[model samples]
Target: MADLGLFGPGTVTWRVHAEPILFVGGLRSLYLQALHPRAMAGVAQNSHYKNDPWGRLVRTSIYVATAVYGTTAEAQEAGRRLRALHARMRARDPFTGEVFRIDEPDLLRWVHVAEVESFITTARQAGVPLTDAEVDTYYDEQRRVAELAGLDPATVPASAAEVAAYYESMQPELRVTRDSAEALVFLTAPPVPWKLNPAVRLGLELGGPRLLYLGVASTALGLLPTWARRLYGGFGLPIEGFTAGLSARALRTALAALPSRYVQGPIYQGAMARAAAAQT
Candidate 1:
């Protein structure tokens, strides 16, 4: 299997395929079960915008951005920019209204783990051959990221046994569902209203699925010669595929119409006003 060029030699794929799976898998576990509950509670217990639609939107945006981009430096920069935009959209008490950043450590841990787990679980589901040692290496690489994030590496569970134990502790707080499995729903359909810049939203909606399709295609293309891979990259075929998958025109159209149908429209405004009044 290793020699079959499932990820091609000397390419980013080879370096990433193994460890990334673990990272995605762990992230799925943390977010879908662990951090999500706390985030919901924080919204209810601490924020004036308890059950605010905007709040849900913010969380979903973060999740979608993270999934499409992964944790690359480019992705982080994009997240920071989006976060700044989000901050400008509302005014509230910084101390408590920023529920998203409150339990950041847990959130980061969950994201890191879910990302790796996603890769691992997806590969396994797709019938990719992987060994236990490969899984361990994946965990070890993720530990480095955790350490960089100021988390104690020792605190991260090493084995599935340890992870299971941690989940057991967090089970009472989680809202589990079949759709929430692997946290893919967060990426595919964020809990929040899609109010992204039309261009950005269009890009994501179109590019998200395209990227996944291309990623799978790239695995097949890996069977080609190094020269062919270089040619593919040089022509930007792979990058284009990746980008196109994430941006959907249909999504853009739907999002473009949402403000009128759900935000500024009478039905939504009335609902929001009632919600606000009830909170006050």
Candidate 2:
């Protein structure tokens, strides 16, 4: 069998990506990505995010899982499929009437940085602590995913300092638009599949998903930088570090209590099998 995808056991990428806490990061990434006007436009116009938020989440989760845990061939195939999809997506800026491709280098870089940073930040804040060096390594290792998105790995931020600088320089381009508001609303309580809970349809109908989303999104929002929070001024309460930390720790513990068969999906299990085989 092929070796574990680009990342394997003992790698910082593996350690960070393996945690269930990263789901909070995924929520944070979408919030931050929407703050970029062009990125939001691409998603709002060209993506089915509004109509099928759960499906979109599942697809994105699968892609990330494949990159971190599947074989080299699997990762490459996933990348190819994503690139082909992006190549056909075009969007127009509502403010400037500027036309751009979703695959544009800069746009791809923005989405890439937002996502990996969210993952790393959420992990650190939510109890999966990393040393300073390991944090940098995680950022550096994620450049492979940036490259997979058709971005130049060299242009992707490879260190904590660089990522901060990148965010600072790009702040001028980030703003809250109509799409941003819509994304926030959609993500705050995206429709859960009725099939996922056949027995509790009545409970689901009584705002179960909204209550759950509020908890998840509060942690995610609290993890955002002060500036990003300011951009979302009336959205909700300000989440301080201590509060986010406690919430994250609780979430991690809850997930850890689940059985491995329920928590570790096929991609994770496949990687474990490969690692075990390599050891033998």
Candidate 3:
């Protein structure tokens, strides 16, 4: 049972997301998702994102971690919780005056693809050594997570080619809104809580948070598609695709060099313990 989650230690998601480089990928996903006006509107209306940005970030990270590492029952429960939450959320489109549920399939699909794109792009570019086939496999494997998010996995893009087509089709629907623009600024320099180590908290108070945020935002901006970059008005400019890929790879290489005990968080550690016990 411990080994029966949607994805375990052996899956591509575990391999890719378990890495600290996913910090960059997560930020990239936020940047990409904001470009969708409808999605941004839903978030802005329904979430305390402006007031507690880091809280939202942590909650999202926890959801992903739970889905990937928790046991089958735990994973299903997490999905159920999210689906129930979304079912209660509704938002109006400021541009069209059209009201929609936050859990609408199309919006969910957009968020799913954007996140998948960021994760795959960041991992591969950052030197994860995944083959083209493995890349496609990674995309296909993520459909399970998509289903958990209340999307019809059968309708979701399951291959690299399909993902590209999906993005191309979505381009017309994607635009930067004032909400998104403001969110981007907030995301780039969101407040960090003072609950961290005293020294670390003090450092964050004295310009440390901004520097960290800039480094991450820069890396995320680098990973964006050229069209998306154009939309942001060069938030991290002079950083075209090639240079961005290089930066991702360099960051991955450096993070990969860190000790596992220092880098792998509680989720990964718990998954490892579960896997070991299951083997016994």
Ranked candidates, highest lDDT first: 2, 3, 1
Error of 1 at 141 (Å): 1.9
Q: Which stretches of candidate 2 lie over 4 Å from their true place?
A: 194-200, 207-209, 234-239
Better structure of 1 and 3 per lDDT = 3
Candidate structures ordered by TM-score, highest first: 2, 3, 1
- The lDDT for every candidate, in the order shown, is 0.42, 0.87, 0.86
With a 3 Å backbone cut-off (N, CA, C), the pairs that clash in candidate 2 are none
State the lDDT of candidate 1 residue by residue for 164-213, as single tens digits: 56656654444533323323333324332366688776776677754663
- Residue pairs in steric clash, candidate 3? none
Expressed as tens digits, the lDDT of each residue in 1-280 for candidate 3 is 4664888767888888777888899899999999999999999999998777788888998898888887777788999999999999999997989999999999999999999889998888888889888889899999999999998889999999999999899898888899999989988877667567987877876776668668768778888888788888875455477787888888778877898877787877888898888888
* TM-score of each model, in listed order: 0.38, 0.94, 0.92
- For candidate 3, the per-residue lDDT at 179 reads 96
Cα-based RMSD of the predictions, in order? 19.2, 2.1, 2.3
